[model samples]
Target: MKYFACFLPIISPEKSQQFRPQHLEYLEKGRNEGKIFANGKFADGSGGLVIYIAESSDEVVELARQDPYVSSGARGYEIHEWEMVTKAVIPK
Candidate 1:
């Protein structure tokens, strides 16, 4: 499976907040399944991001559709296939 990044921009922040609990629950499930690589909202609160593993863009889109934000029509999103070329290691 390849990784895909889904960029979700909040269209209705208040509405999205109402479904936050459900959204977190869904994310936890995905994490436990090892399908979710990373997820977080932008520092400026503009939107959120999620990296997940999938075979194709369509599959990623379907998975994203399950998100409460999108399901509830409180956000809009775009999915892009990601290629990890290199990693940076921070010395502790």
Candidate 2:
């Protein structure tokens, strides 16, 4: 499986706020299903970001389309497929 990081761009602030809870719920479910490796939102509160491990970009796109935020027209998003080239371990 490959990992893809999706960035949501808020389109309708009011609709986004209205569906925020459902959107979170969807993410929580994805987390439990082991589809989401890690996720978070930007500090500026513009939108959301999530990293998902899936078989292919198509799968990632499909998963993202299911998000309540998108389905409800609360927000728009962009998916960026990533290749983790290097990693450095840091003490917590």
Q: For this target, which candidate reaches the highest TM-score against the unseen true structure?
A: 1
TM-score for each predicted model, relative to the true structure: 0.90, 0.89
Model 1 lDDT at residue 29: 91
Alpha carbon lDDT of residue 20, candidate 2? 86
Off by over 4 Å in 2: 85-92
The alpha-carbon deviation from the true structure for residue 91 of candidate 2, after best TM-score superposition, in angstroms, is 14
Off by over 4 Å in 1: 88-92
lDDT of 2 by residue, 1-92 (tens): 89898998899999998998998999999989989887888889898899998999999999999999989888887998888665777223
The local distance difference test score of model 1 is 0.89
How big is the positional error of residue 92 in model 1, measured in Å on the Cα after superposition? Answer: 20
Overall local distance difference test of candidate 2? 0.88
